[model samples]
Target: MTASTAQQVVYDPYSAAFKDDPWPVYRRLRDEAPVYHSQKWGFWALSRFEDVRAAARDHETYLSFEGIDIDDTAKDMSAPGFLPDIDNPRHDQLRRIVQRTFVPRTIAKLEDDVRRVVTGLVDRFADTGTADIAQDLAWPIPYAVFFDVLGLPTTGSDREDLVRWSHGLKDREDDDPRLTPVAWDALHDTKDYLAHVLTERRAHPREDLLSTLVTAEVDDHDGVPYAPARIDRDSEIVGLAFVLFLAGVESTSALLSTAFRELARHPEQAAGLVADPAGIPAAVEEALRFDAPLQVAGRTTTRDVELHGVTIPAGERVFLVYGSANRDERQFDDPDRFDVTRPPQRHMSFSEGLHGCLGAPLARLEARVALEVALPRLGRFEISGPLTRYRSTPNMRVLDSLPVSFTPSGRTS
Candidate 1:
């Protein structure tokens, strides 16, 4: 065994340095302490692919009951945020109610709309040959798609409110009450608005997804017929909506941004993708593997468990470092290298087991469609100015701003 360097290094997820470049720290943790214990945060972290996958699959032992975020006081576990927090059979129940809505076929129906949105977004800034892809294109695709699916009014301040609340929910700072309070407020405000929409849907059910949710029914453990209207009695229904908005918008946006940023830096790779649009799918997959959008997933041990010879006590917090796991040397060959044509392998980016991200299909679709449209329009682009990252949150690899200049292709889809 290698000499322990655990004492010489600290793994602080919130630190600016970690946010900027976490691979080195991740590499050290995987080597020296696969089951890393952070004294400051009072949690155990697993960076290896096998360990994180096992823990994610074994939900009974490593539970998400407390919350999925790193902060102990992060009350996303309460009310509408419970989708990510709750365990089965309740989690299964909630997931089942809305499962059909996000199926591949259902999501497939959005391809035309996705292309329209993507092309329009790209064309909006194509004339100038200069744009922040993150702001202009990446963020709006998922935001518009999700809004349209939910049957929400996707115009003006109402749409802006949805986007604001979606981000506010995730961007909060636990140490600073000022930063976190707005997130709490966004949660409450969005829930209230969703409730209003639910009431309106109840009175006049429509073809929209929210109406389907409001009117959907399922069977309980005892085989009793669960009331469809029971959605009105609790925040669980609203929580489901809240999660769809949060996950759909935030993660996918960050993903598109990161993928494009990488493509811009590696123009040769981007040229290859542009030359053969067929490679865009592989590129998107590589992007997910290369720079995962959401990095860490939280869990709590139900009982004492040993990992890498270290016994973590029952009820202790555990973080499944997906970002680290994706880059683990033992997992992928030349894991750090972003190869578009790497043979497809399962990655922890979308997580694993039953609690995996519900919006994975849609996220993939949004990314592929956006890249297909935008990359061609972008021609050959490069970063025009200093790139900035969103550092308010520790769980995601988000680009705050990515400035770029490109030669307009004058292409129309």
Candidate 2:
């Protein structure tokens, strides 16, 4: 349904229908209500590619210090503003400390490890004839890489707990009031785990990112000239770890699942990659654009602002829908169609600003390596059953299960 100024449509983030497929709603918002206001949720949204990108770039106007989610932004979680919740100066300082670690060069070094993880996952179901790629491959690969990258042990139930915490952090359920509390518990547990790990690593430093965080020093910004101070406080370190967990595991996992689902739907696209593995990079970009892993990003307006002839009042929460913006007709030629070989079009999938995804290089690297290894092995997998999407969180687009049937080569098994 095309929206027009004559008819105003309500956008409720809590609704399950909206969670299922937001493309239609996004299109209407872009065409009709460029600056859509949701009376039910009490928030404004910018769905157009240009509007969303502009809001993301102008961080001063669309501040992150107010928290990044409409629901969580209103609550007092009793925690210091983390990466997604903090603004510049502080954000730049904290991000720089970890930025060097996620550069392409650093991520490229993990190619072998990622391949190994992918190989191991595929081997488990290679002879079974059917596999839920989301569970069997996409899900485990990221957590495995995340644990390895942070120099944490890939043993016991710790990794499982991390996954749980990651999910809880993003899950949003308006029906069940307990959902938010449970999510907070998960967040706290993760922070506590990181604090414990920081203590152990600090006493016995190692060649890992966590250890680097333990020993790194930065300006205190206390006073003139600034005194040097360790940045590894339990509070600060947990925030850093939390952000990494979300980016490294949750979003990357979704990207892989979404990419494979698209591949199963479109054999020709997969054929191109199978024919030449070098084209895997382009496929990855297309996947990121087609079905962005991280869908909605939250921000708050610093003051009254006029957009698309509508004036938004001061201090109103806004959602910059990356999922919608990526599909905006103004941006891509055929927005809805998934074309791997589409011409170069910069997408807002990873966002575009100082607060843009820091783990983008690592995400692309992991997805590319996973595709390079799995696509050739699967030969031509077809969707054997219905795809189940996780609906607890409207912010993320992830599959709980994606069952596919493939003639297993049994080569690695």
Candidate 3:
């Protein structure tokens, strides 16, 4: 609104040559227009930490309704994971139901299980000398952990299908049509599995995430109890499950990969983290802020509102670029350089408001334990192989192969 602020803003996120690396542009947006509308995509992007934080808190103003992008595919498939893509009353109930399963105590209980899984993956790959961090370590940890949490009966079939579908969705191929009939078939099979699980829950409830959903009581806005809505037989639970697996693998793995990528680039920073193990949290925060896993989240405005002097009209679709905001100069000092000691500025990695990720605490736990286990075992891990980026990805400053060589601390007597 002010001339000084106007001087600090820029509109086009895709305009960055480093659109892949858009922090410099986000720096401008946060300084100038904390809430910026982009004409190119015909949407808005929130850049400032405060605005992003506030936007996250109030679900009423900015709704966490379902996404319609690739509507043909997602429309029939938007299964809310008790994570609430709907408005308050419904989202509130759904969120409450799901929240019950991921509490501190529940997650604390899961710590041993999660650690064992991560350690298992490390054990499998540690002796191999080197492996793709995403595929080998970061990806599978969350993939398996989510299944473990959701209480899915994974037969390895689910994972293979999920990875295939995730690749297809993330522009890994040409939307779903590339393998349309086949994609549909795989989705059908997964749905049948979930349906069987749901039915089993109906017959005999268990203490897992799906079972919770199966029996969750939906509280209407009028405070009346209603049976939880049936998960659509044809919904994107499988597709979204794929999203979660990819997210489990991609995002956390990205953090791990990028953390190593950045640390190896600046051994001094990596060395500092190793020097005092407690510092790994700060280092993780820096990794989150400097290069978050999620690049953007899409929303459709229901009413006309102005943010940072930019008017976002009702019915316009916009992307809240979390990756861009993480590097806002107004919020983070030395916006580009990865500084481990930097005070933890609020970031949009898991997003802020109503739609903020339900898996937040779990993802945080996994990543922390991962780095805790990784950095120590890594004993001066260095990128020692060909580096590549995830193809056709919209977010995540990720690498395909983060090859590293750490002093092998093996066979301790």
Which candidate should be chosen as best, given TM-score against the real structure?
Answer: 1
The lDDT values for all models are 0.80, 0.78, 0.63
Which runs in model 2 stand beyond 4 Å of their true positions? 1-7, 73-78, 174-178, 220-234, 410-413
**Model 3 per-residue lDDT tens digits across residues 362-402:** 87788777777766666666678777667533433566677
Where model 1 places Cα greater than 4 Å from the true spot, the runs are: 1-4, 174-179, 220-234, 410-413
Q: Please give the distance, in angstroms, between residue 198's alpha carbon in candidate 3 and its true position after superposition.
A: 1.7
Query: What is the overall TM-score of model 2 with all chains considered together?
Result: 0.91
Model 2 weakest lDDT span, ten residues long: 222-231
| Quality of model 1 by C-alpha lDDT | 0.80
Candidate 2 vs candidate 3: the TM-score winner is: 2
TM-score of every candidate relative to the true structure:
0.93, 0.91, 0.81
